[model samples]
Target: MKIKLLRAATAGLFGIVLATAAHAQKSGGVLRVYHNDNPPSASLHEEVTIATLMPFMALFNNLVIYDQTAKQNTDSTIVPDLAESWSWSPDNTVVTFKLRDGVKWHDGKPFTSADVKCTWDTVTGKRDSGWRKNPRKEWYSNLKDVTVQGDRQVSFHLGRPQPSFLGFLAAGFSAVYPCHVPGRDMRTKPIGTGPFKLASFKSNQSISLVRNPDYWKKGRPYLDAIEWRMVPNRATRVLAFSVGEFDLTFSQDISSRLAADIKAKAPQAICELAQFNIQTQLLVNPIAPFDDPRIKKAMMLAIDRKAFVDILSEGQFRIGGVMEAPPEGVWGIGPEQLADVPGFTGDVSKNREEARTILTELGYGPDKPLKIKVLTRNLPIYREPAVLLIDQLKQINIEGELEAVESSVWYNRLLRKDYNVATNSGGSALDDPDVMFYEAYACGSERNYTNYCDKDMQARFDEQSSTIDPVKRKALVNKIDHDLQAAGVRPSIMHQRGNTCWYPYVHGVSPPQNSHYNNWRFEDVWLDK
Candidate 1:
């Protein structure tokens, strides 16, 4: 039902609220959290999943950061991190940031504008030696060059004006890397100027981050350390949290049903439910039978999207297009408009009938069913929806076998186009069109796992990105979303509404309303107990 934010009403049981400015912050306690899976790597730039961001985001600082104190992150709430101040040139094509002096990397290396240049240069492919994979390189396609004025000043020259450029810098993945650290080393041993330092990252065991004592920000990172125990199973993670084994649950890791179970068991636990703006989508690879446009169209027509929301999320999730649906989302199409988009009509029976008819026309029916393996990540969130997708495909004579893989192997298989059909989740760091379209939909985008590239749609993406007027830009964005659905480009099932619970003793932690990525820097988080 489009839940923006729902908190447990029994406040007296906990007797404590999230730490406000007036509250006295307590420090010197380890915030033990349950991590869902082992991340592919520690490098934020190279990875797409929240597995990496949930643990490692605190280990680095961006040029700008979303105000951690804000309940919702907006353009106005973007505050400085490493950059003391920023300004734009006359035409808005060039933006510059004045560095924060006395800031040092976790390893005690002085932070400078050159490090900023090196970071973006590595992202934009100016330097070849650093990055193993530039997944979000398309996020900086408009960037002409990064020029350093001095040790403290840096300017980014954009080929065209982008209104959301500042927001991009504030994302967790946009953390500025140290110039001296090689990209390969970043995957395991990384260095940054954030409030926390990675003490150790034992794969499949735990990730430990200690407070950066030499952190530039004064009297910050109140917690002594943050420890994330990698527990692959969701039920086990939730069970442990209910019994006070963990101070906090992973970001958006708890389902609606699981939240209820936690409340029943641990009555004092604070549960915050909201739409994380992450969508579960079906990625259809261009293989022999699936390569045909008619086959793709039939595939899109077959499933029931509403069943996913009802069964998996207990009617808490919302059916949406590529962009997150409105209210929480800034640029998404409304329900009326989204219904008109192909496969989103909410008429599952009618849609499936059309799909079956198409299958029959293609000489496939109950006698000759299309057998395929539906690949999904070996996690509850991914696997559950995938199983539902297989059930729905059966209506149209598609015999689907579920193949769940590890997070690392799953991402690699998608990168190599190693699956015929897969169900996965796509998350955007920012709600802006530039970030969403370029990273996931654009031609040659590293994260474009489906390899569905339309030249016309790419041109339209640029048009909306360059359009300065909000109304005009939104119209263009809606058109792109419509076209994307019509073409069946990684057809989105539904935007997820997940729950995250934490004990009252954990203070100053703000769960992001729009994204699962940002607001994770636990610099201000403290332990009241």
Candidate 2:
């Protein structure tokens, strides 16, 4: 059922009157969560869905990690889960980490620095593939070398200093893995140091995880187990949640009204909606017609961002510039700068004329149309935006066609940098500026699919990554953002906000500042009895 404000009130009122069902929440119970997507490929190689794999970090550990509660403050001085403590060199190029003693993988193997070196080497393509897939091939191409100082400690020496490396280490994408296990077959017979071990996974159905008897954290992960079900149908998932068949489910399609109703009716459950760390934007290739700065500007001016935000994002999304949303208020560069760009105007005809003038100046006519394919996906939000862009482009006489491809095919095409124009999103949970800069802007960085090579920007990005001072670093980031926006390779329409709902009993669910809303550490969470 769709959520409405009125319905939410009624739900809340009714919930106050009768909710013996709420009592079911208690310690030592299995938390049934409905994941809206199918089980990812057997390999955990996809950066988007590595959390479900055996133990990237839950059982194993990382040198550093983002805190569960607070979004900022990546603690590197001490090993929160696996390592005990670490030290960095004066240049910040070399990092030495001391591992915790007596930790055992689910398979009963001792954890050591060798595993750390192997994990980094595997993901960075320095070694052969392992049981778990390597998702950070694009992000971790900078490691010069790694050393095992001893059984308990390891050190990573970078070819160049990377200030953001420590923060990247905290994220799940850069999670630590088991080196001894092979990646090819690890998906089925996975093992990790996490509180829960993968028990069984039924393709297209559900995956079950059981608590590890020898969990490192004493008497933790109070729940006996967790079952993650693949249920993409929004209405069905909500029905399951309402009926208590599923303890948690979050969907973008669910209305805010229905969320309020659930809050009113079942106070035991809370509806939370927040901005996601993502930018759904149109990326233009640098090929011929689009290569002209004037054409890009005209195209930018053609569409009304406010309308797209209203129709596609339900007015919940924020019109954005180079920087992404969940703005990371402190670290983010304000959006005010975009207002001054030549085509940043909201006027439609002005933009069209501008585009026409530019195209004509560059030698183009009705006979020689700037015909190109604007690829999109089946996502509901993408449909309206695609239509809006196509309609807007026609005004400027740019004949753009929309091609909707399967997400799998689309992503593959993106990685190959095959499309002329496309719309997509990238997420980072740490909310650090480096997540945006390094992943999206840095030259030769895997995420830079547009082949947008700018020597000046690359030089600045390199300089910025090595700077330890915050003020100087932000200034450098400002330059990078400005240059990227001016290049117009990827222009953002909006930064998406996460729309989700969950039971109140599902406490300690730490939403990522930049990734999926459902990303949470299940360790300290306990159902109220």
Candidate 3:
């Protein structure tokens, strides 16, 4: 099986599918899913928020996509989708893709190389008026140019060789669209060559999608249709799920406490646990006292990460910082190495004592405490953690005030550096170090909410990016990780493990190992009932 998807047309592809379908596979059921938030735009590229990606992932196809079939903690394996196959030039700076022929957009436009070029150009900030914001443009920071080779072929000229370039394209945000479709128009109606086509989308109501009969891959989209509704209240959503109104809880969005309750209510439902890269961190803002390295050290030492795991997840998750920190994570510093990093050790009492000393050195203790407002999302998951953070800060004589903001405004406030201290949750679809470092920690990164801009770390990022050898790159990444912990731009709280529940009747879903809820493989899903 030489990964023959590109040439599957001539290579007995139908035979394989038919053989697989023989295993009690009967299609035609509408999957009723739920997402909590109604998105401002239907396009995945426009906003990489989980609220949007949760529903629209099934409605679009990327150039290359993760092999959802891969059974691993992190499935970095890439497989062809919109692009039939691809090859790289000798220098590794130029990569070319062969588009899948006969694929048509929902609007009946032929899927071609132009679509690939246009999508990349827009994401890389080549277009101005149409794009809402290119938050993840750093994903293509090395991309020099995109050229259409022919009707079905395209080439990407890179300024430098990107080891994980294909992985970037495989991300859910990189889905392809008709080149002629304006960004605003695509977000309005939402059109793609995916298995399902958007039939209707209403703000804060419902999103209806019907199976695309013209899908290039035959016999796919087993579901006749998909109905996505917004249920703002998690309690109501879980109630509906227990009574069999919705098929599954939106992947990884439900809290562990709620998951236990859901399991008690619907014991018949299957609960799948996935450990993603999502981590809650107290972002040490770059404003004033936080800009002082000593204050950052004090804050980092004061918080107890294990308590967060013990309380929130019932000790079911790992505690880590920056890149993931060991056996549970990938390419990160192992425990022995991690012990050297600040705030990673398990001696909580000792760390807190040191934190008190540092706070006292800054000329304040319990008598004259340092009072600050801590901003958090107005959601149960975030608010609970923020409360814990306040308690932890109180131990160090830091009088903390909690302010909960709506989810919509929470991120914008962080992006604008509006808050002095905020507890935020963030995750990457890929566990790749390059993706984490550049987007969240690099200099001038819009996504760097803490406003951390270390030129030394930035230079190291470039070195690791250009380094061809994995061993050398790993060394650079470790050094960078150590520096990040020292800086305490964001103090790691705990990595979250999400338990997504689905009815036994809903079959063929492989839970995503990565943090992305969009990685749910709906194309292979079919209802047993």
Candidate 3: which stretches are off by over 4 Å? 1-23, 73-76, 255-257, 334-336
Worst 10 residues of 2 by lDDT: 1-10
- State the C-alpha lDDT per candidate: 0.85, 0.62, 0.77
Best by TM-score: 1
Report the error of model 1 at residue 262, Å.
Answer: 0.6
Q: On TM-score, who's better, 2 or 3?
A: 3
The alpha-carbon lDDT assigned to residue 478 of candidate 1 equals 88
Cα lDDT tens digits, model 1, 28-85, are 9999999999999999989988999889999899988887877676677677778767
Model 3 Cα lDDT, one tens digit per residue, 1-529: 1112222222145337445764676699898888777676787776757777767787789877776555443423567787767777777788788777888988898888877888888878786538666678887889989999788889989988767677777777778867777778777788888888888899889988898899887878789998989888878898999888999777776667778788898889887787766778888787788778888788888877778888888887676667764555666654355576556776888998999899899987999998999998876667889999999989888999999987667777877889988888777766777788888988877888887787877888888877777788788888777677766767677777877788998887776565554475467788988
For candidate 1, the TM-score is 0.95
When sorted by lDDT, best at the front, the candidate numbers are: 1, 3, 2
How close to the true structure is residue 523 of candidate 1, measured as C-alpha lDDT?
A: 88
lDDT of 1 at 507: 91
Q: Report the Cα lDDT for residue 217, model 2.
A: 56
lDDT for model 1, on a 0 to 1 scale?
0.85
Instruction: Quote each prediction's TM-score.
Output: 0.95, 0.84, 0.92
Candidate 2 lDDT tens digits, 382-491: 65578778876776677888887754455567767888877765455445666666567667766776777777776776787667676887787766765676567687
- In model 1, which residue pairs have backbone atoms overlapping below 3 Å? none
Better of 1 and 2 by lDDT: 1
